[model samples]
Target: MFRLVVACVLISVSLCDDLISVVVIYRHGDRTPIQPYPRDPYRNASYWPVGFGQLTNLGKQHHFQLGQWLRQRYGGFLSPHYSERDFYIRSTDVDRTLMSAEANLAGLYPPKADQVWDPTLPWQPIPVHTTPELEDNLLAMKKYCPKYNSLLTQLFKTEFFLNISRENRDLYAYLSKNSGAQIASLESLEYLYNTLYIESLNKFVLPDWTSGVYPEKMAPWARFSFATQCYTEELARLKTGPLFNEIVEHFRNATKNDGFRKFLVFSGHDVTIANVLNTMGAFEYHCPPYASTIMFELRRNSSFYLNIFYKNSTQVQKIALKGCDFDCDFDDFIRILKPVLITRKQWDLECQNSNFGDFNTIFIYSSIAIGFLISISLLWVIIACFKQVKTNSNDYTRLAIDEVA
Candidate 1:
């Protein structure tokens, strides 16, 4: 293990002639939740001005720094001057992800020559192509990450049961009104919220609305479903997205690929970063916290052999992968790549959810359940009134009728 690591270190320390292209998959900066549940402690919107889980200004700086590092690392390959042909970027159409790409480009390119504006103006916009989250080009889902699936199946199975719950249905009305969405379930709610802010940044706030404490009595899938949705969205996207195909084609036609793509930056979420590594056969990285990024460093050996170094961009900087020597065989690399992404959720389970206890979980979940039920009951009572029901199809109308009728 140590020898392999040494080899990776050596690879990072030098450049190889065989190194032609780079693919960097990165996570977007910090963000807040889309909004708080009415029961949430942080629901008051004061919890975050950008509002829970949205990117802060600090995150912008981080990407800018990374961009500078990239410019320094691949000095010659990329043009000092702006040419549309020189660099290409892609994001997941999320606000933070796309914006981070823009930030990184700002630092990397620095708006050379005619690209620069007034002395006061800064950070020229760089193009970062993207597709919808469900339609993102580079994505994968491992069919068999035991822990992730265990949590997932539990989540899905639990959500199936939640559909029958009175509380969930009632709460849906209140949230639906606020979000202008029909959030029938947690996954739907999460998707609605995740995309809304990812696409419309200024409209939302960033830490998120999570109270960091769920209600005391939680429903079976209440906690699990949100987690599952977060995990599964990437998986579903990967299999169907164009990114994997793009990689396959890129390797197939190496000489035509751009050298200036020193880093194949992918601005996405932690789940995205984790799955990309897992898809590529580095099944060891599990992401924790918001804006977690997994780094894949590609370099050439002394003998001009190709290699890879996998790092999770975190405080400890976990090395889940070592020298992935392709030995000039793209086929070998793809084989490794496919499995790593496929099983990423398993690694995430290890890195993030390995040590949960019954007592704390029970307390947390119970509190959530109690809060959810109370709010739901309030909505339900409002919905239950006949006078409003007779005049309108809207749940909000019924809620209003409760007081009048």
Candidate 2:
């Protein structure tokens, strides 16, 4: 029994040392409400010092702590000093996300040795890449997708959602009267809920009208909206598919190259995190808190494997893939996610509601066919004119010969 226990311990230690790379997708930390309802008491800009939709000091601190947690988790694997080759960070083109990434990096890679430019400052500048929201389909996913929009429209009209709206008519009417904004749709209701939730979190006294239905009555419907973006397989494919596919590619690349990047970080919104979780079928329908994160670790033990973890608060818990175990084989992980994974080209084509390449090919062929027909008609006309002229000349020659005779 003693010998067996020693052998198992040795095997466990070996497996623990096999981590190759990690991908982290995390929400930006807490911020002021996006916007206030028409009747909101805290509507003044002074209430939020950083203006609307910007990160707060509290938010920066939350991300800094999260970064510290990351350092603790990856200290053994990552280099002590910042290295561009080993780490890549991307954030949504939003002020909050950009600032959050900066704050996180401050904690994760504090200046060391020659990296310390200032004796008093412990932080180092790290590059965080971003794309315009209009064109970003990977993290922000704000790029207009016609098919996705059409699906969303269809979803709202479906029996399930229509019933939800019908049942909430009274709630909507009450909220509209109190908040002085239309709250008929789940999306609008969710916005109101978020503002109120943020205000409540900041210890701002809510109006008396909200006491009855502030949280208990409205929370479920608000949370439901988070899942709707990637609720269906088709929606998931068009919405979060590109991000998932990109993460998979990173893991595959790591397998191929020994010197590949060690860590990739994405700073985004709660919706970004929720969409990914829902698409993966591991979401539990709560608003992902500030600085919440989902991590994907690629490991090699006899063979490559994947481990996913979710950190919403103080604790980090291992989350199994919907149909796989905690330590899932890499091949099995890919096979299970095949249904929702999509390439950038596929996403682009699907978003537009048609295969544009095929459409362009057909257009080119049609133009060529039309040009060929026109050329054929011109050639026939030319031949006819030549034949007529030859016939006239022959007649004229015959007439001349007769006259001479």
Candidate 3:
């Protein structure tokens, strides 16, 4: 009986899955609106202490709490002290994202003993890398991709979006009149909605006109607008592909024992979270709240497996990929996402290609290419002629010298 009980305990231990690595992508904490609409009552910088779109004290607290929760959840897996080899962090170039990462790090790796730089402050600096927003294709997704813009424009012109625009024409006109801004498309409407939502969250009294359709009528459209950025497979490939590809590469590296890093953190915006969730086919139409996080955990029992989680509220809920189980085999996870997984080279090619129903773009590129070729050919001909002329000149000189001799 003792031997049997011991055997059962060992078997149970062997069957349990062990988490090996984690990748967390999260939205920045709360912030003031990016910009006020034309007629916003609280448009003055005085109303927002830190000015436009900057993270607030509340935002700092939110991220610090989130970091604490992360430390609690991953205490066993992660090192107690900050180690460059064990953890990595990256944020978009935006000030809010950068500040949020710093606040989160303050909680995640609070100084202890010899690591303490300032004992009074109880905090230590940790590196958070970033690229310029315009050049960042990985996190910000703001890199200029003409093809992506072209695809989005085409998507807006589709019958479904057209119908939505026609249906919301009255609402758009009403908003435009009240806000003193042109609210024509869902995109424009979403921007207004976001500003108003942020103002409301900050306890600013909204104008009377907002009562008619502030959230009830406009919220759905605003949430749906997030979906439009990555509505199609092509858009997903261009928008979220680089980040997802990087995540998968990290997992692959861990499986092969190629990298020592076990924790990766990405601080970005709501749209960043939305894009990732949408690409994973797990997004539902709702604004990802401030400081919301998506975790990709790699674990091993006998073989490797993946478990995805979303923490929008206090609870972190398991989110399975569409057509995949909650605890999915690593190989199966890769196979399922293979269709959406895009390499950096493929993303670049797709972004530069004008094959997506944009004849004008195609014509412009073709003209550039033809002009380049023609210019090169003309230069080559000119150089050849000059060389031939010099050769003839040399021959004539040699002939004259022979006659003289």
Ordered by TM-score, highest first, the candidates read: 3, 2, 1
TM-score of each model, in listed order: 0.54, 0.85, 0.86
Candidate 3 per-residue lDDT over residues 350-400, each given as its tens digit:
788755455577788889999999999999999999999999887733554
Q: Each candidate: what lDDT?
A: 0.52, 0.88, 0.86
TM-score of 3: 0.86
Q: Give the winner by TM-score.
A: 3
> 266-362, model 2: which lDDT tens digit per residue?
9999999899889878998888889999999887767888878889877777688888887788999999889889998888877876333456776
Sorting all predicted structures by lDDT, with the top scorer first, yields: 2, 3, 1
- What is the Å distance of residue 69 in model 3 from its true position? 0.5
Q: Cα lDDT of model 3 overall? A: 0.86
Q: After best superposition, candidate 1 residue 359: deviation in angstroms?
A: 48
Model 2 bad stretches (over 4 Å) = 1-15, 354-405
Error of 1 at 184 (Å): 15
TM-score of 1: 0.54
Q: Higher-TM-score candidate among 1 and 2? A: 2
